[model samples]
Target: MRFRKTGAPISFIIPSGNLGNGVAALWTKKMGLPIQQVHFAHNANHAVVDYLNSGDYEPSDTISTLANAMDVGAPSNVERLKALYPDFSLLKRDVAATSVNDASIQNAIRKSEKHWGQIICPHTATAATVREQIGESTNEWVLVSTAHPAKFETIVEPLIGKPVEVPAPLKAILLNPSQSQNISPNLLELLDALSGPKV
Candidate 1:
């Protein structure tokens, strides 16, 4: 989580799920950069469309794509992001947003496998689409690989036409004993846990 900028505009694209909120918070805390959280109405096709059409931010020609996890229609942490960076106008000037569709994602997977021989998960594919949109002349742009590709073995295997190998560390998660604790999605319930006595 080192926040090194290679003198290029940085944009963080997050999936619309529980994890997206945490990712935004971590980046805001770690990088101390203003984040533009893309919020999609549940029925909206593209989360970044309105933001782009407003003429507030210029869109990049190079957009990126990721698979299943990238299927986020509405991100939940946009207000947190704005609050973290009060100087919103300056922040909007440097950062832009876009999302890749399923078709584009599959094409990207085929293209990358053909060109680089590397298999990236759908989320990574989304980031790659953005990077490519930015063009080759841009500096080092980092894409967050949220999880291992092996997690989606069935889909990825068919795309690459081979079995994907699981990293040694991740293999442990598959082997080890684990437990799950279910919690209600209500904010008040979550707050009660935080306000409760230490475990």
Candidate 2:
């Protein structure tokens, strides 16, 4: 909201899942910036396999993959998205929804490492795949790298054929976190917290 208020064009590219949808509404309604929602072909686990086989194989209709963070079978954000963008054509013009399988994501990771020598997490890999599919346009596209590669070192290291380095900021978390909360994946519970009385 602040970004849009400051006259900056904000574009949010999100994975296909309820998580992405929740915030997307707030941004569009409150900020009036464009939002592009992208759907990944593979779930968390099989993202690598899907990316590897992307060229010849079509995206699977079944929603199964490894990347657990993004394993959303039915994204609940669709209604809000429709409400936000009433004109379908305009939505299509400004907002884009592309599906990139796991193969493409892995390819992007490898390419980014080989070409740019940067280690990006799976979320960033998905963003890169979408950016490539969108082609090079005059629009200044900024991809939000959601997490540090080290977050998924187990999956990323072997693929890159090297150990991924942890950024200085994230190293602290790796060292020791005070506590972690395990909450039920219930939207109502989340909304209740968000809508609770202000302190």
Query: What TM-score, over all chains together, does every model reach?
Result: 0.62, 0.63
lDDT of 1 by residue, 1-199 (tens): 3334433434444433323543454456347564333322111135444443463432223323235554443444444544554575643544456555666656666677879998877656665665676576433344555667788777677888889899998888889988644669989878877676567
Candidate 2 lDDT over 1-199, as tens digits, reads 6545665444555554344543453355357455333233233433223322342212233465434466654444545555665665654455554556677767888888989898887767877877777776645556767677888888788778999988787887768858644558999777766676567
TM match of model 2 to true structure: 0.63
| Number of backbone collisions per candidate | 10, 15
The local distance difference test score of each candidate is 0.53, 0.58
Any idea what lDDT model 2 has?
Answer: 0.58
